[model samples]
Target: METLANLESFVRSADHGSFSEAARRLALTPAAVSRNVAMLERNLGVRLFHRSTRKLTLTEAGEAFRNAISGSLSDIQAAIAGAANGGGEPTGVLKVSLAPTFGTMHILPLLPAFIARYRGVRPEWHFENRQVDIIAEGYDAAIGGGFDLSPGVVARTLAPAHIIAVSSPAYLAGRKLPAGPADLAELDGIVMRSLQSGRIRHWTMRDAAGEQIPAPLREVFVFNDPAAMRRSALLGLGVAMLAVPDVIDDLESGALIRVAPRWYADAGAISIYFASRTLLPGKTRAFIDYIVDAFKQRRLAERFAGSLG
Candidate 1:
Protein backbone atom coordinates (compact mmCIF):
# COMPACT_ATOMS: atom_id res chain seq x y z
CA MET A 1 0.00 0.00 0.00
CA GLU A 2 1.15 3.54 -0.80
CA THR A 3 1.71 5.64 2.31
CA LEU A 4 0.62 9.28 2.65
CA ALA A 5 4.19 10.04 3.82
CA ASN A 6 5.46 9.03 0.38
CA LEU A 7 3.05 11.44 -1.31
CA GLU A 8 4.17 14.21 1.01
CA SER A 9 7.82 13.51 0.17
CA PHE A 10 7.09 13.63 -3.60
CA VAL A 11 5.15 16.89 -3.26
CA ARG A 12 7.95 18.50 -1.26
CA SER A 13 10.69 17.25 -3.62
CA ALA A 14 8.95 18.69 -6.70
CA ASP A 15 8.46 22.10 -5.00
CA HIS A 16 12.08 22.51 -3.83
CA GLY A 17 13.55 21.19 -7.20
CA SER A 18 15.76 18.60 -5.48
CA PHE A 19 15.36 15.61 -3.18
CA SER A 20 18.26 16.78 -0.98
CA GLU A 21 16.79 20.24 -0.49
CA ALA A 22 13.29 18.85 0.25
CA ALA A 23 14.80 16.34 2.69
CA ARG A 24 16.68 19.15 4.42
CA ARG A 25 13.44 21.12 4.73
CA LEU A 26 11.52 18.08 6.06
CA ALA A 27 14.37 17.03 8.44
CA LEU A 28 15.06 13.79 6.52
CA THR A 29 18.03 12.50 4.58
CA PRO A 30 18.21 12.81 0.76
CA ALA A 31 18.16 8.99 0.36
CA ALA A 32 14.88 8.83 2.31
CA VAL A 33 13.23 11.38 -0.03
CA SER A 34 14.45 9.51 -3.11
CA ARG A 35 13.09 6.16 -1.80
CA ASN A 36 9.70 7.77 -1.01
CA VAL A 37 9.35 9.40 -4.44
CA ALA A 38 10.63 6.28 -6.23
CA MET A 39 8.19 4.07 -4.32
CA LEU A 40 5.31 6.44 -5.16
CA GLU A 41 6.19 6.50 -8.88
CA ARG A 42 6.65 2.70 -8.89
CA ASN A 43 3.26 2.25 -7.23
CA LEU A 44 1.53 4.43 -9.83
CA GLY A 45 3.65 3.18 -12.77
CA VAL A 46 4.18 6.77 -13.95
CA ARG A 47 6.86 9.38 -13.74
CA LEU A 48 5.86 12.37 -11.55
CA PHE A 49 8.93 14.59 -12.13
CA HIS A 50 11.55 14.60 -14.93
CA ARG A 51 14.95 14.39 -13.37
CA SER A 52 18.25 15.72 -14.85
CA THR A 53 21.71 16.89 -13.76
CA ARG A 54 20.85 20.61 -13.97
CA LYS A 55 17.16 21.14 -13.10
CA LEU A 56 13.84 19.49 -12.22
CA THR A 57 10.43 19.98 -13.89
CA LEU A 58 7.02 18.34 -13.52
CA THR A 59 5.68 15.88 -16.04
CA GLU A 60 2.02 16.57 -17.07
CA ALA A 61 1.12 13.59 -14.87
CA GLY A 62 3.16 15.12 -12.00
CA GLU A 63 1.14 18.36 -11.89
CA ALA A 64 -2.19 16.49 -11.87
CA PHE A 65 -1.05 14.10 -9.13
CA ARG A 66 0.28 16.93 -6.95
CA ASN A 67 -3.00 18.85 -7.16
CA ALA A 68 -4.94 15.77 -6.06
CA ILE A 69 -2.47 14.74 -3.35
CA SER A 70 -2.01 18.25 -1.90
CA GLY A 71 -5.62 18.86 -0.93
CA SER A 72 -6.09 15.30 0.32
CA LEU A 73 -2.93 15.56 2.48
CA SER A 74 -4.24 18.70 4.14
CA ASP A 75 -7.57 17.02 4.84
CA ILE A 76 -5.91 13.89 6.18
CA GLN A 77 -3.73 15.93 8.55
CA ALA A 78 -6.72 17.93 9.79
CA ALA A 79 -8.78 14.75 10.30
CA ILE A 80 -6.01 13.15 12.33
CA ALA A 81 -5.83 16.11 14.70
CA GLY A 82 -9.62 16.33 14.93
CA ALA A 83 -10.05 12.62 15.58
CA ALA A 84 -7.52 12.72 18.39
CA ASN A 85 -9.28 15.56 20.18
CA GLY A 86 -12.83 14.53 19.32
CA GLY A 87 -12.33 10.87 20.19
CA GLY A 88 -10.79 11.59 23.58
CA GLU A 89 -12.45 12.48 26.84
CA PRO A 90 -14.70 15.52 26.52
CA THR A 91 -14.17 18.09 29.28
CA GLY A 92 -16.34 21.08 28.34
CA VAL A 93 -20.09 21.37 28.59
CA LEU A 94 -22.04 19.48 25.92
CA LYS A 95 -25.21 21.28 24.85
CA VAL A 96 -28.18 19.33 23.46
CA SER A 97 -31.58 20.45 22.19
CA LEU A 98 -34.46 17.96 22.01
CA ALA A 99 -38.22 18.01 21.41
CA PRO A 100 -40.46 18.55 24.45
CA THR A 101 -42.69 15.47 24.34
CA PHE A 102 -39.80 13.27 23.27
CA GLY A 103 -37.50 14.96 25.73
CA THR A 104 -39.90 14.56 28.61
CA MET A 105 -41.22 11.07 27.89
CA HIS A 106 -38.45 9.30 25.97
CA ILE A 107 -35.06 10.96 26.35
CA LEU A 108 -35.40 12.28 29.93
CA PRO A 109 -36.12 8.81 31.24
CA LEU A 110 -32.91 7.76 29.42
CA LEU A 111 -30.47 10.38 30.75
CA PRO A 112 -29.86 9.23 34.32
CA ALA A 113 -28.85 5.78 33.11
CA PHE A 114 -26.34 7.19 30.61
CA ILE A 115 -25.01 9.66 33.17
CA ALA A 116 -24.32 6.82 35.50
CA ARG A 117 -22.29 4.97 32.85
CA TYR A 118 -19.90 7.79 31.82
CA ARG A 119 -18.41 9.91 34.60
CA GLY A 120 -16.14 12.15 32.52
CA VAL A 121 -18.77 14.25 30.76
CA ARG A 122 -21.54 16.54 31.98
CA PRO A 123 -24.50 17.35 29.72
CA GLU A 124 -26.64 20.48 29.58
CA TRP A 125 -29.99 19.82 27.96
CA HIS A 126 -32.53 22.28 26.52
CA PHE A 127 -36.03 21.09 25.75
CA GLU A 128 -38.47 23.03 23.55
CA ASN A 129 -41.74 22.27 21.82
CA ARG A 130 -41.28 24.79 19.04
CA GLN A 131 -38.70 24.35 16.30
CA VAL A 132 -35.62 26.59 16.43
CA ASP A 133 -32.29 27.10 14.69
CA ILE A 134 -29.75 24.61 16.07
CA ILE A 135 -26.74 26.67 14.99
CA ALA A 136 -28.19 29.98 16.10
CA GLU A 137 -29.24 28.33 19.36
CA GLY A 138 -25.67 26.95 19.87
CA TYR A 139 -26.81 23.38 20.33
CA ASP A 140 -24.31 20.63 19.59
CA ALA A 141 -26.88 17.88 19.17
CA ALA A 142 -30.62 17.79 18.54
CA ILE A 143 -33.44 15.27 18.58
CA GLY A 144 -36.01 15.84 15.83
CA GLY A 145 -39.12 13.89 14.89
CA GLY A 146 -41.00 13.53 11.57
CA PHE A 147 -39.78 17.00 10.59
CA ASP A 148 -37.18 17.24 7.83
CA LEU A 149 -33.77 18.23 9.10
CA SER A 150 -31.88 21.17 7.59
CA PRO A 151 -29.44 20.54 4.74
CA GLY A 152 -26.48 21.38 6.97
CA VAL A 153 -27.27 18.75 9.58
CA VAL A 154 -26.17 15.10 9.76
CA ALA A 155 -28.99 12.84 10.94
CA ARG A 156 -29.06 9.35 12.49
CA THR A 157 -32.12 7.33 13.29
CA LEU A 158 -32.78 6.72 17.00
CA ALA A 159 -36.25 5.21 17.01
CA PRO A 160 -39.52 5.54 15.15
CA ALA A 161 -42.71 7.49 15.90
CA HIS A 162 -45.80 5.34 15.42
CA ILE A 163 -48.87 7.53 15.79
CA ILE A 164 -51.99 5.42 16.18
CA ALA A 165 -55.70 6.10 16.53
CA VAL A 166 -57.05 4.71 19.77
CA SER A 167 -60.22 5.16 21.81
CA SER A 168 -61.81 3.90 25.01
CA PRO A 169 -64.11 0.88 24.59
CA ALA A 170 -66.85 2.83 26.38
CA TYR A 171 -66.70 5.47 23.63
CA LEU A 172 -66.89 2.85 20.83
CA ALA A 173 -69.32 0.37 22.49
CA GLY A 174 -72.66 1.46 21.03
CA ARG A 175 -71.07 3.43 18.11
CA LYS A 176 -70.08 1.97 14.77
CA LEU A 177 -66.28 1.33 14.62
CA PRO A 178 -64.86 2.67 11.38
CA ALA A 179 -63.99 -0.29 9.13
CA GLY A 180 -62.17 1.88 6.56
CA PRO A 181 -60.10 5.09 6.73
CA ALA A 182 -62.84 7.19 5.08
CA ASP A 183 -65.34 5.94 7.65
CA LEU A 184 -63.56 8.07 10.30
CA ALA A 185 -65.67 10.96 8.96
CA GLU A 186 -68.70 9.23 10.51
CA LEU A 187 -67.04 8.95 13.95
CA ASP A 188 -66.70 11.65 16.60
CA GLY A 189 -63.01 12.30 17.30
CA ILE A 190 -60.71 14.49 19.35
CA VAL A 191 -58.41 16.11 16.79
CA MET A 192 -55.04 17.60 17.64
CA ARG A 193 -54.49 20.97 15.99
CA SER A 194 -50.88 21.86 15.48
CA LEU A 195 -50.07 24.95 17.57
CA GLN A 196 -47.76 25.90 14.72
CA SER A 197 -50.65 25.69 12.32
CA GLY A 198 -54.23 26.82 12.94
CA ARG A 199 -55.73 23.64 11.39
CA ILE A 200 -56.40 20.32 13.02
CA ARG A 201 -54.00 17.39 12.60
CA HIS A 202 -55.68 14.79 10.37
CA TRP A 203 -55.52 11.07 11.01
CA THR A 204 -53.42 9.55 8.18
CA MET A 205 -53.49 5.85 7.27
CA ARG A 206 -52.14 3.32 4.79
CA ASP A 207 -53.10 -0.01 3.20
CA ALA A 208 -51.23 -3.29 2.50
CA ALA A 209 -50.32 -1.85 -0.89
CA GLY A 210 -48.26 0.87 0.88
CA GLU A 211 -50.46 3.74 -0.19
CA GLN A 212 -50.52 6.56 2.37
CA ILE A 213 -53.85 8.33 2.48
CA PRO A 214 -55.10 10.93 4.93
CA ALA A 215 -58.50 10.28 6.50
CA PRO A 216 -60.69 13.31 7.10
CA LEU A 217 -61.71 13.39 10.74
CA ARG A 218 -64.67 15.23 12.23
CA GLU A 219 -63.28 17.00 15.27
CA VAL A 220 -65.65 17.00 18.27
CA PHE A 221 -62.94 18.61 20.42
CA VAL A 222 -59.59 19.98 19.26
CA PHE A 223 -56.59 20.12 21.57
CA ASN A 224 -52.97 21.21 21.03
CA ASP A 225 -51.45 18.56 23.31
CA PRO A 226 -51.42 14.84 22.50
CA ALA A 227 -51.40 14.08 26.21
CA ALA A 228 -54.58 16.11 26.62
CA MET A 229 -56.19 14.42 23.62
CA ARG A 230 -55.18 11.07 25.12
CA ARG A 231 -56.82 12.10 28.40
CA SER A 232 -60.02 13.03 26.54
CA ALA A 233 -60.00 9.74 24.66
CA LEU A 234 -59.56 7.85 27.94
CA LEU A 235 -62.73 9.34 29.49
CA GLY A 236 -64.63 7.81 26.51
CA LEU A 237 -64.74 11.12 24.66
CA GLY A 238 -63.43 10.03 21.23
CA VAL A 239 -60.56 8.48 19.28
CA ALA A 240 -57.30 10.43 18.92
CA MET A 241 -53.98 9.91 17.14
CA LEU A 242 -51.46 9.72 19.94
CA ALA A 243 -47.81 8.67 20.37
CA VAL A 244 -47.46 5.06 21.43
CA PRO A 245 -46.03 5.69 24.90
CA ASP A 246 -48.75 8.19 25.72
CA VAL A 247 -51.40 5.44 25.55
CA ILE A 248 -49.37 2.30 26.44
CA ASP A 249 -50.90 2.15 29.92
CA ASP A 250 -54.50 2.34 28.71
CA LEU A 251 -53.94 -0.11 25.88
CA GLU A 252 -52.33 -2.70 28.22
CA SER A 253 -55.12 -2.26 30.78
CA GLY A 254 -57.73 -3.00 28.05
CA ALA A 255 -59.23 0.47 28.59
CA LEU A 256 -58.56 1.60 24.98
CA ILE A 257 -59.13 -0.08 21.63
CA ARG A 258 -57.04 0.33 18.46
CA VAL A 259 -59.18 1.85 15.75
CA ALA A 260 -59.22 1.81 11.92
CA PRO A 261 -56.18 -0.22 10.77
CA ARG A 262 -56.34 1.41 7.35
CA TRP A 263 -55.30 4.73 8.86
CA TYR A 264 -52.12 3.35 10.44
CA ALA A 265 -49.27 3.82 7.94
CA ASP A 266 -45.73 2.59 7.97
CA ALA A 267 -43.79 3.67 11.04
CA GLY A 268 -42.26 7.10 10.75
CA ALA A 269 -38.87 6.94 12.44
CA ILE A 270 -37.75 9.87 14.61
CA SER A 271 -34.09 10.92 14.22
CA ILE A 272 -31.29 12.38 16.27
CA TYR A 273 -29.30 14.94 14.30
CA PHE A 274 -26.24 17.10 14.67
CA ALA A 275 -24.57 19.93 12.76
CA SER A 276 -22.61 18.46 9.85
CA ARG A 277 -19.69 20.85 10.03
CA THR A 278 -19.13 20.32 13.73
CA LEU A 279 -17.13 17.31 14.87
CA LEU A 280 -18.92 15.27 17.51
CA PRO A 281 -17.13 14.92 20.82
CA GLY A 282 -16.50 11.43 22.21
CA LYS A 283 -19.10 11.97 24.87
CA THR A 284 -21.75 12.82 22.26
CA ARG A 285 -20.94 9.65 20.26
CA ALA A 286 -20.89 7.60 23.46
CA PHE A 287 -24.24 8.97 24.55
CA ILE A 288 -25.80 7.98 21.23
CA ASP A 289 -24.53 4.43 21.68
CA TYR A 290 -25.51 4.41 25.32
CA ILE A 291 -29.08 5.48 24.50
CA VAL A 292 -29.41 2.88 21.73
CA ASP A 293 -28.01 0.21 24.05
CA ALA A 294 -30.42 1.15 26.81
CA PHE A 295 -33.27 1.02 24.33
CA LYS A 296 -32.45 -2.61 23.57
CA GLN A 297 -31.42 -3.86 27.02
CA ARG A 298 -34.28 -2.21 28.84
CA ARG A 299 -37.90 -3.26 28.23
CA LEU A 300 -38.44 -0.41 25.73
CA ALA A 301 -38.97 -2.96 22.96
CA GLU A 302 -41.55 -4.91 24.99
CA ARG A 303 -43.30 -1.72 26.05
CA PHE A 304 -43.44 -0.43 22.46
CA ALA A 305 -44.83 -3.80 21.29
CA GLY A 306 -47.49 -3.83 24.01
CA SER A 307 -48.35 -0.22 23.19
CA LEU A 308 -48.63 -0.95 19.47
CA GLY A 309 -51.08 -3.80 20.11
Candidate 2:
Protein backbone atom coordinates (compact mmCIF):
# COMPACT_ATOMS: atom_id res chain seq x y z
CA MET A 1 0.00 0.00 0.00
CA GLU A 2 1.26 3.50 -0.85
CA THR A 3 1.73 5.84 2.07
CA LEU A 4 -0.26 9.07 2.30
CA ALA A 5 2.93 11.01 1.70
CA ASN A 6 3.46 9.22 -1.62
CA LEU A 7 -0.11 9.91 -2.74
CA GLU A 8 0.20 13.54 -1.66
CA SER A 9 3.42 13.90 -3.63
CA PHE A 10 1.83 12.45 -6.74
CA VAL A 11 -1.30 14.63 -6.46
CA ARG A 12 0.54 17.86 -5.71
CA SER A 13 3.01 17.16 -8.49
CA ALA A 14 0.12 16.61 -10.85
CA ASP A 15 -1.65 19.74 -9.63
CA HIS A 16 1.39 21.97 -10.03
CA GLY A 17 3.03 20.15 -12.98
CA SER A 18 6.41 20.47 -11.22
CA PHE A 19 8.10 18.49 -8.46
CA SER A 20 9.70 21.65 -7.04
CA GLU A 21 6.35 23.40 -6.59
CA ALA A 22 4.83 20.29 -5.01
CA ALA A 23 7.84 20.05 -2.72
CA ARG A 24 7.41 23.68 -1.71
CA ARG A 25 3.74 23.09 -0.88
CA LEU A 26 4.47 19.88 1.03
CA ALA A 27 7.53 21.30 2.81
CA LEU A 28 9.65 18.50 1.41
CA THR A 29 12.79 18.49 -0.72
CA PRO A 30 12.26 18.15 -4.46
CA ALA A 31 14.32 14.95 -4.41
CA ALA A 32 12.08 13.51 -1.70
CA VAL A 33 8.91 14.30 -3.64
CA SER A 34 10.37 12.86 -6.83
CA ARG A 35 11.43 9.72 -4.94
CA ASN A 36 7.99 9.34 -3.39
CA VAL A 37 6.37 9.61 -6.80
CA ALA A 38 8.90 7.12 -8.19
CA MET A 39 8.06 4.69 -5.41
CA LEU A 40 4.32 5.05 -6.11
CA GLU A 41 4.87 4.44 -9.83
CA ARG A 42 7.02 1.39 -9.09
CA ASN A 43 4.41 -0.05 -6.76
CA LEU A 44 1.68 0.50 -9.35
CA GLY A 45 3.91 -0.97 -12.11
CA VAL A 46 3.14 2.01 -14.43
CA ARG A 47 4.82 5.29 -15.25
CA LEU A 48 2.60 8.16 -14.15
CA PHE A 49 4.33 11.26 -15.48
CA HIS A 50 6.10 12.00 -18.75
CA ARG A 51 8.94 13.98 -17.21
CA SER A 52 10.94 16.61 -19.04
CA THR A 53 13.51 19.05 -17.70
CA ARG A 54 10.91 21.83 -17.73
CA LYS A 55 7.61 20.22 -16.62
CA LEU A 56 5.84 16.98 -15.66
CA THR A 57 3.05 15.87 -17.96
CA LEU A 58 0.47 13.31 -16.84
CA THR A 59 0.18 10.16 -18.94
CA GLU A 60 -3.23 8.69 -19.88
CA ALA A 61 -3.16 6.22 -17.00
CA GLY A 62 -1.97 8.94 -14.64
CA GLU A 63 -4.76 11.27 -15.68
CA ALA A 64 -7.30 8.53 -15.09
CA PHE A 65 -5.77 7.70 -11.71
CA ARG A 66 -5.73 11.36 -10.67
CA ASN A 67 -9.38 11.81 -11.65
CA ALA A 68 -10.29 8.65 -9.73
CA ILE A 69 -8.58 9.77 -6.54
CA SER A 70 -8.61 13.58 -6.42
CA GLY A 71 -11.94 14.08 -4.63
CA SER A 72 -11.40 11.03 -2.42
CA LEU A 73 -7.92 12.24 -1.60
CA SER A 74 -9.26 15.61 -0.48
CA ASP A 75 -11.86 13.93 1.69
CA ILE A 76 -9.26 11.61 3.17
CA GLN A 77 -6.95 14.49 4.03
CA ALA A 78 -9.81 16.46 5.56
CA ALA A 79 -10.89 13.41 7.54
CA ILE A 80 -7.35 12.87 8.78
CA ALA A 81 -7.09 16.51 9.82
CA GLY A 82 -10.47 16.36 11.59
CA ALA A 83 -9.46 13.21 13.41
CA ALA A 84 -6.10 14.65 14.48
CA ASN A 85 -7.85 17.58 16.16
CA GLY A 86 -9.76 15.25 18.54
CA GLY A 87 -12.80 15.63 16.27
CA GLY A 88 -13.64 19.16 17.51
CA GLU A 89 -11.05 21.54 18.91
CA PRO A 90 -9.42 23.52 16.10
CA THR A 91 -5.64 22.96 15.94
CA GLY A 92 -3.37 23.37 12.94
CA VAL A 93 -1.67 25.85 10.64
CA LEU A 94 -4.46 27.91 9.09
CA LYS A 95 -3.16 29.02 5.70
CA VAL A 96 -5.06 31.96 4.24
CA SER A 97 -4.70 34.40 1.33
CA LEU A 98 -5.87 37.98 1.56
CA ALA A 99 -5.76 41.24 -0.35
CA PRO A 100 -3.03 43.40 1.18
CA THR A 101 -4.78 46.61 2.18
CA PHE A 102 -8.12 45.09 3.22
CA GLY A 103 -6.43 42.28 5.09
CA THR A 104 -4.10 44.65 6.96
CA MET A 105 -6.82 47.16 7.77
CA HIS A 106 -9.81 44.91 8.55
CA ILE A 107 -8.92 41.23 8.84
CA LEU A 108 -5.53 41.58 10.56
CA PRO A 109 -7.13 43.55 13.41
CA LEU A 110 -9.39 40.56 14.09
CA LEU A 111 -6.41 38.20 14.39
CA PRO A 112 -5.56 38.99 18.01
CA ALA A 113 -9.05 38.00 19.09
CA PHE A 114 -9.01 34.94 16.84
CA ILE A 115 -5.69 33.68 18.19
CA ALA A 116 -6.83 34.36 21.75
CA ARG A 117 -9.93 32.26 21.17
CA TYR A 118 -8.33 29.45 19.15
CA ARG A 119 -4.77 29.31 20.35
CA GLY A 120 -4.15 25.95 18.72
CA VAL A 121 -4.57 27.32 15.19
CA ARG A 122 -1.47 29.15 13.94
CA PRO A 123 -2.21 31.61 11.15
CA GLU A 124 -0.02 31.49 8.05
CA TRP A 125 -1.28 34.45 6.08
CA HIS A 126 -0.16 35.66 2.63
CA PHE A 127 -0.93 39.32 2.04
CA GLU A 128 -1.18 39.73 -1.74
CA ASN A 129 -3.20 41.60 -4.34
CA ARG A 130 -4.18 38.73 -6.65
CA GLN A 131 -6.74 35.96 -6.57
CA VAL A 132 -5.39 32.57 -5.45
CA ASP A 133 -6.55 29.07 -6.26
CA ILE A 134 -7.81 27.89 -2.86
CA ILE A 135 -7.37 24.15 -3.35
CA ALA A 136 -4.51 23.99 -5.83
CA GLU A 137 -2.39 26.38 -3.72
CA GLY A 138 -3.32 24.61 -0.42
CA TYR A 139 -4.87 27.71 1.12
CA ASP A 140 -7.42 27.07 3.88
CA ALA A 141 -9.30 30.22 3.02
CA ALA A 142 -9.04 33.56 1.23
CA ILE A 143 -10.59 36.99 1.77
CA GLY A 144 -11.17 39.27 -1.21
CA GLY A 145 -13.62 40.56 -3.80
CA GLY A 146 -14.42 39.32 -7.32
CA PHE A 147 -13.17 35.73 -7.10
CA ASP A 148 -14.37 33.34 -9.75
CA LEU A 149 -15.92 30.47 -7.80
CA SER A 150 -14.02 27.41 -8.86
CA PRO A 151 -15.38 23.90 -8.41
CA GLY A 152 -15.41 22.72 -4.76
CA VAL A 153 -15.11 26.26 -3.36
CA VAL A 154 -17.72 28.48 -1.73
CA ALA A 155 -17.79 32.19 -0.88
CA ARG A 156 -19.53 33.79 2.09
CA THR A 157 -19.88 37.53 1.80
CA LEU A 158 -18.60 39.59 4.71
CA ALA A 159 -19.26 43.16 3.55
CA PRO A 160 -20.17 45.33 0.59
CA ALA A 161 -17.26 46.12 -1.73
CA HIS A 162 -18.47 49.66 -2.36
CA ILE A 163 -16.07 52.28 -3.66
CA ILE A 164 -16.05 56.04 -3.19
CA ALA A 165 -13.91 58.97 -4.24
CA VAL A 166 -11.69 60.48 -1.57
CA SER A 167 -8.97 63.14 -1.25
CA SER A 168 -6.88 64.73 1.47
CA PRO A 169 -8.43 67.82 3.13
CA ALA A 170 -5.41 69.89 2.09
CA TYR A 171 -5.89 68.97 -1.57
CA LEU A 172 -9.60 69.79 -1.50
CA ALA A 173 -9.19 73.00 0.53
CA GLY A 174 -8.69 75.33 -2.43
CA ARG A 175 -10.73 73.35 -4.99
CA LYS A 176 -14.42 73.70 -5.83
CA LEU A 177 -16.47 71.01 -4.04
CA PRO A 178 -17.99 68.58 -6.50
CA ALA A 179 -21.79 68.45 -6.64
CA GLY A 180 -21.83 65.24 -8.74
CA PRO A 181 -19.59 62.59 -10.21
CA ALA A 182 -19.09 64.49 -13.46
CA ASP A 183 -17.51 67.40 -11.58
CA LEU A 184 -14.77 65.06 -10.29
CA ALA A 185 -13.09 65.23 -13.75
CA GLU A 186 -11.86 68.76 -12.90
CA LEU A 187 -9.57 67.43 -10.11
CA ASP A 188 -6.24 65.70 -10.30
CA GLY A 189 -6.86 61.94 -10.23
CA ILE A 190 -4.90 59.19 -8.52
CA VAL A 191 -5.99 56.09 -10.43
CA MET A 192 -5.23 52.38 -10.39
CA ARG A 193 -4.09 50.28 -13.33
CA SER A 194 -5.59 46.83 -13.66
CA LEU A 195 -2.95 44.22 -12.97
CA GLN A 196 -4.66 41.74 -15.25
CA SER A 197 -5.70 44.07 -18.10
CA GLY A 198 -2.98 46.75 -17.94
CA ARG A 199 -5.61 49.48 -18.30
CA ILE A 200 -6.54 52.32 -16.01
CA ARG A 201 -9.77 51.43 -14.22
CA HIS A 202 -12.78 53.74 -14.39
CA TRP A 203 -16.16 53.40 -12.73
CA THR A 204 -19.65 54.80 -13.12
CA MET A 205 -20.76 56.44 -9.90
CA ARG A 206 -24.37 55.97 -8.89
CA ASP A 207 -26.53 57.95 -6.50
CA ALA A 208 -29.33 56.62 -4.30
CA ALA A 209 -31.79 58.31 -6.61
CA GLY A 210 -30.75 55.83 -9.40
CA GLU A 211 -28.77 58.39 -11.34
CA GLN A 212 -25.50 57.29 -12.91
CA ILE A 213 -22.58 59.44 -14.12
CA PRO A 214 -19.14 58.61 -15.46
CA ALA A 215 -16.24 59.39 -13.10
CA PRO A 216 -13.48 60.77 -15.32
CA LEU A 217 -11.10 62.40 -12.89
CA ARG A 218 -8.01 63.86 -14.64
CA GLU A 219 -5.39 61.08 -14.45
CA VAL A 220 -2.37 62.76 -12.86
CA PHE A 221 -0.96 59.64 -11.23
CA VAL A 222 -1.49 55.93 -11.78
CA PHE A 223 -0.59 52.90 -9.67
CA ASN A 224 -1.00 49.14 -9.97
CA ASP A 225 -1.97 48.69 -6.35
CA PRO A 226 -4.89 50.20 -4.45
CA ALA A 227 -2.75 50.78 -1.35
CA ALA A 228 -0.42 53.00 -3.37
CA MET A 229 -3.38 54.95 -4.77
CA ARG A 230 -4.75 55.48 -1.27
CA ARG A 231 -1.34 56.65 -0.10
CA SER A 232 -1.09 59.08 -2.99
CA ALA A 233 -4.52 60.50 -2.10
CA LEU A 234 -3.50 60.74 1.57
CA LEU A 235 -0.44 62.79 0.56
CA GLY A 236 -2.85 65.38 -0.92
CA LEU A 237 -1.59 64.58 -4.40
CA GLY A 238 -4.96 63.93 -6.04
CA VAL A 239 -8.45 62.51 -5.69
CA ALA A 240 -8.63 58.71 -5.64
CA MET A 241 -11.45 56.22 -5.85
CA LEU A 242 -10.92 53.61 -3.18
CA ALA A 243 -12.82 50.83 -1.50
CA VAL A 244 -14.76 51.93 1.59
CA PRO A 245 -13.33 49.16 3.81
CA ASP A 246 -9.81 50.25 2.87
CA VAL A 247 -10.21 53.95 3.66
CA ILE A 248 -12.92 53.82 6.34
CA ASP A 249 -10.54 54.61 9.22
CA ASP A 250 -8.85 57.41 7.31
CA LEU A 251 -12.24 58.91 6.43
CA GLU A 252 -13.36 58.64 10.06
CA SER A 253 -10.11 60.18 11.32
CA GLY A 254 -10.55 63.24 8.98
CA ALA A 255 -7.40 62.35 7.02
CA LEU A 256 -9.42 61.67 3.87
CA ILE A 257 -12.58 63.49 2.89
CA ARG A 258 -15.28 62.13 0.58
CA VAL A 259 -15.66 63.83 -2.80
CA ALA A 260 -19.18 64.05 -4.19
CA PRO A 261 -20.47 62.38 -1.03
CA ARG A 262 -23.75 61.30 -2.58
CA TRP A 263 -22.12 59.38 -5.42
CA TYR A 264 -20.33 55.98 -5.12
CA ALA A 265 -19.56 52.83 -7.11
CA ASP A 266 -20.83 49.34 -6.34
CA ALA A 267 -18.10 46.83 -7.02
CA GLY A 268 -19.45 43.73 -5.30
CA ALA A 269 -19.21 42.05 -1.89
CA ILE A 270 -16.04 41.31 -0.02
CA SER A 271 -16.19 37.59 0.69
CA ILE A 272 -14.42 34.83 2.58
CA TYR A 273 -13.87 31.76 0.40
CA PHE A 274 -13.22 28.18 1.41
CA ALA A 275 -13.47 24.72 -0.03
CA SER A 276 -16.95 23.23 -0.18
CA ARG A 277 -15.96 19.98 1.41
CA THR A 278 -18.24 17.57 3.22
CA LEU A 279 -15.58 17.17 5.89
CA LEU A 280 -13.85 20.51 6.46
CA PRO A 281 -10.81 20.76 8.72
CA GLY A 282 -11.70 22.06 12.17
CA LYS A 283 -9.27 24.98 11.97
CA THR A 284 -10.80 26.19 8.70
CA ARG A 285 -14.34 25.89 10.02
CA ALA A 286 -13.47 27.77 13.19
CA PHE A 287 -11.86 30.57 11.17
CA ILE A 288 -14.87 30.88 8.87
CA ASP A 289 -17.30 30.99 11.77
CA TYR A 290 -15.26 33.49 13.74
CA ILE A 291 -14.91 35.93 10.85
CA VAL A 292 -18.58 35.69 9.82
CA ASP A 293 -19.74 36.20 13.40
CA ALA A 294 -17.38 39.09 13.99
CA PHE A 295 -18.53 40.86 10.86
CA LYS A 296 -22.15 40.57 11.94
CA GLN A 297 -21.43 41.69 15.50
CA ARG A 298 -19.51 44.72 14.27
CA ARG A 299 -22.09 45.55 11.56
CA LEU A 300 -19.33 45.99 9.02
CA ALA A 301 -21.70 45.18 6.17
CA GLU A 302 -23.71 48.34 6.80
CA ARG A 303 -20.64 50.49 7.25
CA PHE A 304 -18.98 49.27 4.04
CA ALA A 305 -21.94 50.13 1.85
CA GLY A 306 -20.83 53.08 -0.28
CA SER A 307 -24.46 53.73 -1.26
CA LEU A 308 -25.06 54.77 2.36
CA GLY A 309 -22.59 57.60 1.94
Please report the candidate that would top lDDT against the real structure.
2
Taking all chains together, the TM-score of candidate 2 against the true structure is 0.90
lDDT of 2 by residue, 159-196 (tens): 98999999999999978999999999899999988998
- How high a TM-score does candidate 1 get? 0.64
Candidates' lDDT values, in order? 0.72, 0.93
Task: Give the per-residue lDDT digits (tens) of candidate 1, residues 58-122.
Answer: 89999999867765664564466457666555444567887776677778887776777666668
Total backbone clashes of candidate 2, pairs 3 or more residues apart or in separate chains? 0
Model 1 misplaced regions, further than 4 Å: 1-88, 211-213, 296-309
Candidate 1 has an lDDT of 0.72
TM-scores, all candidates, are: 0.64, 0.90
In model 2, which residue pairs have backbone atoms overlapping below 3 Å? none
RMSD (CA, Å), each prediction:
12.9, 2.3
